[model samples]
Target: MRGSRITRLFRTRPMTHETPYEADTSRRRPTVLKALVFIVLMGLVIAGLLAAATLLRSEEGPKIAIAEPEPLAVSVIPVEYLTELDIDELFTGIAEARRTSRLGFQTGGRIERIDVRVGDRVKAGQTIARLDTRGLGAQLASSQAVVEEARSAHQLALDTADRQRQLQAQGHISQQRVDEVVSQAATAMARVDAAKAQADTIRVQIDLASITAPYDGMIVSRFADEGAIAGPGQAILELVEGGALEARIGVSARVVSELVPGDIYTLEAETGPVDAPLRSVTGVVDPSQRTVAAIFDIPETTGVPAGSIVRLKMERKLEEKGFWVPLKALASANRGMWTVYAVVGEGEDESWRAQPRLVEMVYPAGERAFVRGPLEAGDRIIVDGLQRVTPGARVVPREVQRAEAASGG
Candidate 1:
């Protein structure tokens, strides 16, 4: 029993080394748990860092695209209707005298006296110039002397012929002698007739040596001086008749077709406005100018000097066919051509876009142009703000009133 008790006590008693071993085991377990917790926390932190880096890289790359921009807003007008208009066509013309003449001497001679200078008024039968007639007068006097001598000889011949006939009747002279006297008398008579004719011719020439005005006129130019020698039929002076004035103008064939013989028109002269009546229209066209001559008779009281340039205003209704558009709608292009932006798209879902249409401006009346182009009726054309849009660019068109478009507002 004693041995059993001793062994049980020794076995139940706590050893010093045993207690320290239990404490060491307990400390080791706590350290292992702390290391495991640190490892798990580090793993979690590294995983979170990797996820954040991946997210930042994805954000730095290019993004997905968005929708396109909206279209621009613009005002548009439809193609206008054709109308007949009385358009005034202006032409430049020169004022002229109704009667113009270039006067010259009939015979060649040295000039002696010029009575009238340039711009001198002259009347009918007034002597304007004269040639030296000293030699002509001497010749005329000599011719008259010869005529007088011939007349005396003719009287003697007549007396002799009568005496010869009487002698033949009295039988005192032979028949042959009477015949000889008659022949002599006939020769003398013939000489007298020739002398008289020559004297008359010289007298007529002396009258022609003085240059006289054939009608009332004003001298415009002088070609021969007082001492200059002039040939026969050479121009000596240029004269223009007063009291009636005329205007000569060159116009197109189309204008000539609209004119009449007595149609009245207005002329803007340097002095003032005057009424000019159409006198004549030439049937032939001038080849160089491709125009026809139109003559108009104006009153002399207008005081418009000859060769004064004046403007002729004429208005006529024409059957023209074209569309009128605002000047802002036109875009300058190459070779004097013009472009207009038109809205081409249709329906609500379709987006309206700019489309270029070529046009030619025929006539410009006021702020609008009469244009002809490849455009259909009712086609919408952008008028306001063409610079803000381009061809093929989407545009929102706002319709404009026809009256507003016509008024160019």
Candidate 2:
């Protein structure tokens, strides 16, 4: 019985024992299979995430943004509703004398002396100069001697004729001899009369040697000096008569109709402006230039030199009230046709936009222009930066007052 119990205990102990290699093999096979399954699942998840990222990127739309507009700098003049101001049409012209004369000697002679110089004032019939009178004096002396000699011969013939007449009446001498003496006496008296007339002519010729001024005027020039030979029709000096000056201006045919004689005008000189009256308008028109000559008489004023340049301003008949803008505001698409850009308000927040407006320009006044348009008073217009502006474009209104203050207006 002891031996059988020992065998059963040994078998039961042996039944709990196993090989190490077999245990390891079984555990490693399951672990490797679980690892492969985990790798496959992780790979599928990563691929799905990459595909979703690519699709999201391709389906996205473009990003858009808007920027604020830049502010504009501008200047503006106030518009007011006032009475129509009569603006004169200013014309550029030169000043001249109303009556200018080139004084010269009527008779040729050597200049003995000059009594007047430039800027010298003289009166009418004033002796301005004298010439050499040596030849003239000699001729007058010879004429006077002939007159004396003829007078003596006439007296002797008169006495002889009277005695002969008395003798013939008393029959003391032959009639033919008395008649001969009477005819001689008559011829001698005729010779005396001719000699006296010739002497008188010579006397008058000597008086013209002195050159005198024809009217009251100021001497503007002196062409001949002392001892200079002066010929006939040679200008010796220049004279401005009547103390009146004039300006000769060329007026176009379109404006010539408004100019007439006795119209008043203003002339701008270096000193200041002066009032002048229109003297005359030339009837003959210059065919080549299509202009007429306008003459304005300037009043006598001190220091207003003749031949100086001046500008003439004349009033026109047609007048109206309109906006006067600078010439740069006008744009030309064709000859005589002009347009400008005007700003019209669209809404309170949207501001105004540029709108092309047509105008008819009548004439130019200095740097400003006078135009006729459908726009009324207080219309805002762009005077500068017109090329960048277009119709229906959004713009930021830059206050003109603020810009002017910044620029030290």
TM-score of each model, paired residue for residue:
0.63, 0.60
lDDT of 2: 0.76
Q: All models: lDDT? A: 0.86, 0.76
**What does the lDDT read for residue 55 in candidate 1?**
79
In candidate 2, stretches whose alpha carbon ends up further than 4 angstroms from where it belongs are 1-73, 76-85, 88-100, 174-176, 242-322, 331-333, 344-356, 374-379, 385-396, 400-409
The residue pairs in collision within model 1 are none
Local accuracy of candidate 1 as per-residue lDDT tens digits, 1-409: 9999988998898456557788889879988999999999999999999998897789676677998678787898889768675677788888988788888789989999889999899998999898898898999899889888888888888899899899899999999998888888888888889998998898888888888998888999999899899899889999998777889888888877788889788889888898889999887899998888889898877788887887787787867766889999999988888999988885787678899999988778778788888888898899989888788888876543345467897
**What does the lDDT read for residue 147 in candidate 1?**
84
Question: Candidate 1, which ten residues in sequence have the lowest lDDT sum?
Answer: 396-405
Give the backbone clash total of model 2.
Answer: 0
Q: How accurate is candidate 1 locally (lDDT)?
A: 0.86
